[model samples]
Target chain A: MSDKHMSSQFDADLNLVSSKVLEMGGLVEAQITRAMHALNDFDIEIADQVIAAEETLNTMEITIDEECSNIIARRQPAARDLRLLLAISKTITNLERAGDEADKIAKRVKRLAEDGSSRTVNIAEIKLSGEMAATILRRALDAFARLDTVAAAQIVRDDKAIDEEFRAFVRKLVTYMMEDPRTISAGLEYLFIAKAIERIGDHAKNIAEFIIYIVKGTDVRHKSRDALEREALS
Target chain B: MSDKHMSSQFDADLNLVSSKVLEMGGLVEAQITRAMHALNDFDIEIADQVIAAEETLNTMEITIDEECSNIIARRQPAARDLRLLLAISKTITNLERAGDEADKIAKRVKRLAEDGSSRTVNIAEIKLSGEMAATILRRALDAFARLDTVAAAQIVRDDKAIDEEFRAFVRKLVTYMMEDPRTISAGLEYLFIAKAIERIGDHAKNIAEFIIYIVKGTDVRHKSRDALEREALS
Candidate 1:
């Protein structure tokens, strides 16, 4: 193949991989929302849907991983191309973990629903935080798709809000458990769900870091959000 | 340099990076043990040590990551060499998160110690699970170091025991909280610690999967332990 043709072929392969990642991201984003809704409305159908979708998420991860490995083995891509493949592989893992978190939430919600305790507590804050997590997740995927490090940094900043919401839910649930021993079972369930949402936010932040890394070739992980922002923008 | 000399140079660099990862793994193993000890003995000093060591863990991760990136950029390693770099990069992230989980456990232990709640429960089972998690972690790193797929598969099997232990702790804690509302605060603390330990086991399992991927070039994650055992043996 001519050099130009080979470069275009690599681009086409890269685009195919990027689109697969986006598809997985979209599925995961929907999974979070549906999980939250299932918890909020005691909808077992949505809960089961999320559970069923977990397999698809796993398959997508494996496919994308294989594609990345194939690209590296065949193209021997260097520098920026190599970095992009690395970022995609890492981000997909995070996205799949986020999907797992969503599955956890859905499973717990299913149990709560079955036990008839799903609506026992005021889950308004939990629902709100779940929405925020999903939103940040979608935005992170967007930032990744666009290679927009600044927007990725913004998603990192947004995770703090979801974390605060998680803490607030924890405090509220703890208070409820303390006030009434009878509520302890339901409270613990809520605690796990809230914690899952918090983890989803962390996964989103991880994906955001991969975005910045792909764009700037810097490992922004383990850094403060402020540091990430400054580094990504500068 | 001759091709022979260049190949040896790459091998030396690879060995150096592997040793660094093993060093980080050892520290993380000790962190898990000490965190459990702090929780068991209510040892604030040990808890503080684990908390302080988290920064070093982060630094080691960054160092290993930089080494892999430099090797990739300079050598443009292909096929197995490239796969090794990819696996090392991913495994270090898992190790760093495992370190984070240990730090979380230690922090919770410190708080519980301050409240004089660490001794409220027997905690023998929790300590046992922590030991199992650390053992599996050490073995996973060893597998990666030696490219032992069977040992990695065995670590995956071992994690099941830790998960069962975690569930047992959860059941016991829930009963305690239900029987006495006053124990809710301390119970929640233990819950978080047990959850952290369980998550540490998960990170170990993740590392094991990476080792398998590096050895066999197959993604064995999200599969049953039985399937992984079969694949690793095959």
Candidate 2:
């Protein structure tokens, strides 16, 4: 094949792999959204569906990783292409882990459903926080697809707000538990769900970091938000 | 340079990178061990130390990742060497996350220390489980260093035991919190600590999976424990 033909073929392969990563990201987003809804409404069916879909997420992770490995071996892609491949492989793991966090939330909901507790604790704050977490994740994935470092950096900054919301929700739950020990079980479940959402936010931040790295070849992980934003702009 | 010398240089570089990964693993193990001790004794100093060491762990992770990228670019390592680089990079991330879990445990300890609650709950189970988690992590890293798939598989199996212990601990803590709402704050802290230890075990399992992939060239993640055991035995 001619050089131009080979380059175009490689681009096609890269595009295919990128599309698969996006597909996996979409599924993970659904898992988070469904799991949160399950918690909010005490829907066992949605929770069970999230649990069932975990296997599919796991399969997607393995397939994407294998495809990355194959491309690396076959193409020996250099510099930017290589960095993107590395980022994609790492991003999938984070996405699958975010799915695992969602699955954890679903499992808690499943237990709550089995208990059949009629005591409706106020989860409004949790609901709002969960939405924020999901939005951050969706926006992070969007930044990744577009390689938008500015947007990625902004999402990384957004994680702090989610974390603050999580802490506030936990404090409120603690007060509620103190007021009525009867709510402890359900309250504990909500705490875990809140934590799961916080972790999802962290995974989204990780994806954002990957985007920054891919775009600028800078390792922005573990850096302060201030520094990251400056670097993203630079 | 001759082919022999070039091959030797590549081997040296790989060894250096692998050793760095092991070093990072050692720091993570220390973090877990110290965090557990701090939780058991309410040693604020040890907790502070763990918190302080987190920066070093983060730095190590970034350095090791960069080294892996450099090796891939310079050596263009193929097949087994390539797989090892990928696994090392991933394993370091898991180790760093496990370190983060330890840091979370330490931060909780810091809060508990300030609260000055004189009530001593039965944390023996949690301590044992934490030790088990640390042991599994150490073994997983050793397996990676030696490429021992059998040891990795055993570590993977061992994670279930930690999960069982975590669940039992949480149930007991929940009972304590319900029996005496006064213990709710500390009890919740213990719950978070237990969850962190459980997550550390998960990171160990992830490392074990990487080791298995490095050895057997098969993705064992998302499979049933029974299936994983069968594959191990096979």
- Tens-place lDDT per residue, model 2, A195-224, is 989999999999999998998888999999
Q: Model 2: residues >4 Å from true position, as ranges?
A: A1-6, B1-6
Quickly count the clashes in candidate 1: 0
The RMSD of every model to the true structure, in order and in angstroms, is 2.8, 2.7
Instruction: Return the lDDT, model 1, position A192.
Output: 91
Weakest ten-residue segment in model 2 chain A by summed lDDT: A1-10
- CAPRI-style class, candidate 2: medium
Best by DockQ: 2
| TM-score to native of every candidate shown | 0.96, 0.96
Give the per-prediction TM-score of chain B. 0.95, 0.94
Superposition error at B233 for model 2 (Å): 3.9
- For candidate 1, the per-residue lDDT at B143 reads 87
